[model samples]
Target: MSVRDLNLPQREPSRGELPSRVTIWEVGPRDGLQNEQTVVGLGTKLEFLDRLAAAGLGTLEATSFVHPKWVPQLADADDLLAKLDRRENVRYPVLVPNERGLDRALALGVESIAIFGSATETFARKNLNRSFDEQFAMFEPVVRRARHEGLEVRAYLSMCFGDPWEGAVAVDQVVTAGRRLLDMGCFQLSLGDTIGVATPGHVEAVLGAFDDVTRLAVHFHDTYGQALSNTLAALRAGVTTVDSSAGGLGGCPYAKAATGNLATEDLVWMLDGLGIDHGVDLDALVRTSAWMAQQLGRPSPSRVVKALTGG
Candidate 1:
């Protein structure tokens, strides 16, 4: 079927104080498939990235360079990069846990890399196996080296809104942690609602602490069914970049309560209604997610994908 045959959302006139163009940072290949029980083959992963890029997703998080023991699903990161048919207009970023992961990414000629960090002490110890403050000590060299190598470094600050082990994360605490990553030469910091417990008001409060919204990206999970609303709130606060997983495919391997990242199709639907120019072809994106869901041997959790494909 052609893209025009899909039941697409009608584009309304652009309103409100939101940015005219939003950049949807697609994370399906990396974060989406990292914790899957059914291991997706290397060819499927590469094709997933290709399909997403063909759907007009400009920035695709290709995969993680973490130790295979941690995320065995993405063990073929080296081969994936070597055989990837990279597009000149597309940006493919990989997740690198530390200096060693950075080395692997650097060896593959990766231009952009992301380092994951935690906001709360409990999560830091659990996810990174280091204390909250000590985690930065580890990332400092990674960020510094990546900068020196002329690679753009992005930081992921998890548990920004709420943590399962730790209660409500203070807005100021999140701000300070995010600032540390930014000061260390990271170009963009993605504030993650790891547990998906963030509300719109809480999202506004947390984002309000940051001085520059341009350097901020919001990664929301839909565990509490608030991801899209919180994302809209973030968009209103001048954030243009959003991290979403295609077909709603990922959940935290460490944080069990964290369900899935915001679905790219769902976000695109809301953006379409708001008349936001996100450069994504909604019909094509829905089709891509639907195909990915089939590969995973499950239905997509995305409302937009389900609605468009009658899944």
Candidate 2:
């Protein structure tokens, strides 16, 4: 199938050379739907996961193990995991907010877990109720133990670009936090533009700081409409993993200005044009996003989905 076959807006990479193939970490389940106001049915969430895997996304962030008081929408994480008809050759990673969350994930024998640490002080205080350094200290034991127990750990560093309270953040600060997390046993680090303020230049500078760009993943929110462009910038800089939410569903409860994440359908459309083998079926992805949109009773916000579905 070609880009025209999928009704995607044809565009070429505006920057440097691109990777031959990229790995997309689908975060629709945890990062995207968690911010939704309505309580999505457990069966609906399960079906969404199945459809995404069928669409060829191998790595899916399933659910967050945070306490119900924090994210009530995902209180069914346990039930969702237990009742899920697990698919082979597809990974379901869950978010662990703290040591207690790790305990819950351990009970389920989770293979991969992601923990978040913020780059700015204000977000750290608001999200974790701790100082910037304090949050790392808290994550240290959790990461160490989880790694020791044989689990693939991913670390997310939020607010790598501009911050609402602190204005523009320095690239050095992001690298420092990312390096700390990597040294602490996180196999891969995801740099998050939590407020969706990152530009292409910032993407290059941050990825340039890392010794090995392959160990880093770029997670961009679409609030500023820079996610795709910034992802291209990361690819130009040698980063291969891109994190996106299906149907563009996302927001940050802690970050007041955070909006939706970059939609997987849109990302795949661009990757299709770039000839980057992401292993995603555009039609299946659009159908899956459309199905989820119907379940939510709202149109999918992805441009590609809207164009293909004629929404």
- Can you give the TM-score per candidate against the true fold? 0.95, 0.95
Q: What is the C-alpha RMSD of each candidate to the true structure, in Å?
A: 2.2, 2.1
lDDT of 1 by residue, 1-311 (tens): 32234566555544656878899999989999997987899899889999899989999999999888888999999999999999879999999998899989989999999999999999999888999999999999999999999999999999999999989999999999999999999999999999899999999998888999889999999999999999989988888899999889899999998898999888887877776788988888888888888888889999888887987
Once model 1 is optimally superposed onto the true structure by TM-score, how far is the C-alpha of residue 232 displaced, in angstroms? 0.7
For model 2, how does the per-residue alpha-carbon lDDT over 28-51 read when each residue is reduced to its tens digit? 999998899988999999999999
Total clashes in model 2, counting residue pairs 3 or more apart in sequence or in different chains: 0
lDDT of the candidates, in the order given: 0.91, 0.90
Cα deviation at 124, candidate 1, in Å, is 0.9
Which pairs clash inside model 2?
A: none
Q: What is the Å distance of residue 266 in model 1 from its true position?
A: 0.6
**Residue 28 miss distance in model 2 (angstroms):** 0.4
What is the overall TM-score of model 1 with all chains considered together? 0.95
lDDT of candidate 1?
A: 0.91
